[model samples]
Target chain A: MPPAHPPVDTADVFALLERGRALSTPVLRAAVGRLAPPMDTVAAYHFGWIDAEGRPADGDGGKAVRPALSLLSAEAAGSAPETGVPGAVAVELVHNFSLLHDDLMDGDEQRRHRDTVWKVHGPAQAILVGDALFALANEVLLEIGTVEAGRAARRLTTASRKLIDGQAQDISFEHRERVTVEECLEMEGNKTGALLACAVSIGAVLGGADDRTADILESYGHHLGLAFQAVDDLLGIWGDPEATGKQTWSDLRQRKKSLPVVAALAAGGPASEQLAELLAADAKSNDFDSFSEEEFATRAALIDEAGGREWTSQEARRQHTVAIEALSRVDMPEHVRAQLTALADFVVVRKR
Target chain B: MPPAHPPVDTADVFALLERGRALSTPVLRAAVGRLAPPMDTVAAYHFGWIDAEGRPADGDGGKAVRPALSLLSAEAAGSAPETGVPGAVAVELVHNFSLLHDDLMDGDEQRRHRDTVWKVHGPAQAILVGDALFALANEVLLEIGTVEAGRAARRLTTASRKLIDGQAQDISFEHRERVTVEECLEMEGNKTGALLACAVSIGAVLGGADDRTADILESYGHHLGLAFQAVDDLLGIWGDPEATGKQTWSDLRQRKKSLPVVAALAAGGPASEQLAELLAADAKSNDFDSFSEEEFATRAALIDEAGGREWTSQEARRQHTVAIEALSRVDMPEHVRAQLTALADFVVVRKR
Candidate 1:
């Protein structure tokens, strides 16, 4: 209903993220460089550090959201962000590993306005490089050689396993006729929430936070991750191609069973029936190209009429509230808490 | 070249392998069971514990040679085989992770007398399950939670990296027209030797062996792995389908540039030229099935005529000798030494 806390300064959070990226990118680069050639080259390209031809190119790797959260969680635990660099690098690697493999699995050829690893290097190399990065993540944690290394590795591994589980469920969902909202949420929680939770918990652990604080940070991350995915699904259906850096109506054209679509399907009304009929007709035609702009517009309108859009927006706001509440459970410096709140607000509200 | 050690009792070595398998398979199964279902189902089917329909089947998972080596190394270092069970389980998981992913990448439909994970579960599931298992391997090592856990994980990660590197090189070699014997050996060393060496060294490290003893054991495993691959290449060319569970001349039919084929091509003689011509002709035809049985026989004869057969056999024997000598460098109980020697002997001499 109303805001429980004052609005956070989004610019400050972005600045912190930039600061986090600046601190972690070199460490991430050095860790990735340890891989043998071709793998290292592919990784560099994936990170937007180099062109496919190996020349330097300016590219945005990602928003650095996970690492920023890691750094902020560390600061909230009363440590400098530098103490969380290992955790930050690790979460980023795991994130990229999932992205590289997910692109191959989903057959997405474009990532961040460039060719995906599989598109450029072939699927075999893409698969191997993803694996190398996954291994590199663990090796980096272990190489830290502190008592915290073992615990950090364990948390990362658990999160990674959940991420794989969520991905598997996501793939399975594409083939299913209908998926419940509850199931969709579970899958999203595992797929997106686990890593985000791990990012926060790892930072807290590394920053010498007690178990209670780490658990609270993880809760904050879990809700924030759900909010992030909810907004992402919304963008997939409605955001401008120029802003999202993807083809217009790409997910609908591919008949992706994203959360919004699933929620609408589960809504069970005349609008839901019409939306189902449209999707079924598209499936029968088996020609994605034949679906014109009018058809896509109609489909988007039907989704909204079925209350999917409203449901997702409300869910994102609800999760954002829960995320902020979790942050309040831990007593931290006022500034650090403000930063975490800003990140949560950003997760729910980002347009791209 | 003469025997520096007496011949090992093959029966005793097989018995040891059986014991190691019995101890480690349950641990492996429990570890694998921790994965979410469908992934676990695919894994169980891949392990040959069940048929495609999930019914129990009498399927041999593998020879469990690596686990046996781990156990034997532990014993040689004055610990019980159970002390090496974690290492055994970790090695087996890494080995199977490779098998699952390699099958998908190489388009192999069959393995261990059944459809591969990718063939049965699809590439997406196969990829995710392989990732899960790889993470599981590291998780298992970390859960051991002793001071040794970090070292064990570091070694496993290093070996897994080399293993991935080797697989990448092997894939690259498939595209190249020619590969040197040295390069082939280097690839094989990374592909096959790294895991085997890790198997021995992990056991030694867990068993409290000093650096010298672990190094010697690792040396033993390196040569033993080379010998194992050499014999395997030989089998690919000449082994019977009934015993090897593969088509006759399968590697040649697929135009695989395995070690023997590469060595034959490098010989640069009349036979080598003829073999190259035959392969080039096959490539031009683009119909592997069009090759008559007589043509296949002729190709096999050319490999022999080019000294590929003799060279592979000689290399196997030489490596077998070297493997035993490395074992000899480590002074252990006489019986344990005999078991390691027997295992090495068995590796180079197995028919299938």
Candidate 2:
């Protein structure tokens, strides 16, 4: 059987990223100066322009994946990409704001292989800094400068709440002994799917797409988010640490109640019972390194027996199929739709 | 001179307070269920109706001052008092969100003589609860169900950023040796004045008042905030803790660079050396209690000699004049205008 993938031109994605930054950097630059000067350092860090010190560091570090999706969806829905640049940037700013706060909440000290904002700046400064970004996102929406712009702000605001709601649910599951796959999906819908859906909807709204086209694009984004997260869960355990840049079995160590763990737990049997005991023991232990490699192999075998990996991979493909169906539902320009569909497949099937 | 005090119609103000609560409480109740169920106790405590254990506590705390002002402003602008209830509640929710995060940032463990949300729930939970409130505020604005109703959300988002910016400046000021009154005012304008201005503007916007009327109400609110802070500065040193419920001379012990302190520092006299030395003393030591008292007396004398107190007082009166002038600029019913003018006077000259 052949791998089912769409035609993605990496060149198009790279070009959109460059052009999107050129259009949006000015807004961020102008707003950063107006921000409380004390937070300028952290804000700069968030943009990946500077390190904790006042000196400049890297140029730009984020994937810009969310904003690109927004801009591309707008273009595919028949609007110029430039028209939705502000919304694209606004969506990304909101995304980064949540990332900064999430890092603090989750107690992760490193992000992008450097000290996270809170670790360098302290929780007080980091919280306020994240708040400033949120405000800036709202301000950017106002810069949309039209009636439809107000409508767009309203939609983004709703998405913001859903994102937080998802985060809250994810945190709640940490202590729970039982969690269903349906409940897990709902949580991800808020945490991962809502913003992706918003990205496409905002882009289409700002792009002047009709309501039907925008709805179709929204559905596409929603399924794409689910597919992305499913693949992400698969990679959490199976992918190489060197390739993924994540600590080996870090999710298991954290007892994160991730999708795969929940699925494995739901498929109860002797293997599941053993996995549960290991988790309980791991939760009580301070030394994670002591957990033997053989133990990990056993756990991996158990996960396979429960069809955890296969289930998630299959679910990822299913979501992508739905995304393609959503794409077909809209009257998108053929080339743009093809590119977007290809991007969707790449997200689900990529190894890392 | 006979003090030109605004008439205090306590009954009217209290009624508006009840109306504001009636509108806002339900929104919170509805949203609370969606947060982490385990963390809902923390959220409830922050609202002041329940303890950290989720049991009923004391009566509603915090005077609901801003919300009352909002509803009253709408009434004073010739709309029915109930007309502004939705917006009044929205502003209050935003205010509470800031207060929660501010308490965390300030490291204040006590609020209204009870443990802060962070103290009982931990920082991570507190952060999410505050975020939930922020999201809920935006949701409430949308629930108001008018295109113009969203104007309040926009103003709130703007003010929320300004408040954070002002706070950023405040945090930075602690590290600096000298800060000018202009800089202080600019910071206060964002931190303190912005929200009050929004609170007042929201009222007029909800009342269906024109832009000019909203601007006038905003001016009234701005002046009221300035005057209120000025009086609060005075009370920080001289007011009885029994009446005010704040620690006596707490601001002095903290060596805060408030308006009066900045005014005295800028005077440039022989006493300036002693003032600087006292401020230079460690803020976290028990010696702060003794050193602060003597220095406070000396600084108060210097402030009087340098005309600092007089200048601040005169500024307050001037702003009050401007607020009244704004009221006259707008076309409203005579009784309503008088009521708002009275409210303006009450803000600057309140005794406790």
TM-scores across all candidates? 0.95, 0.90
> What DockQ, on C-alphas, does every prediction get?
0.72, 0.55
Badly placed stretches (over 4 Å) of model 1 are A1-7, A280-285, B1-8, B208-212, B280-285
Q: Tens-digit lDDT track for model 2 on B186-285?
A: 8777777888888888877777777777777788777777777776676666657665556666566556677777877787776665666656655434
DockQ of 1: 0.72
Per-residue lDDT over A157-248 for candidate 1, one digit per residue giving the tens place of the 0 to 100 score: 98999999999888887777778899999999999999999998887788778778888988999999998988888888998777787777
- lDDT of all predictions: 0.86, 0.74
TM match of model 2 to true structure:
0.90
Please write out the lDDT profile of model 1 over residues B140-253, one tens digit for every residue.
Answer: 888877767677777888889899999888888777788899998988888898899889878777877777887788888888889888888888889876677667887787
Report the C-alpha lDDT of model 2 over A84-163, residue by residue, as the tens digit. 77788778778888888888988877666567888988898888888888778878876555666666777778888888
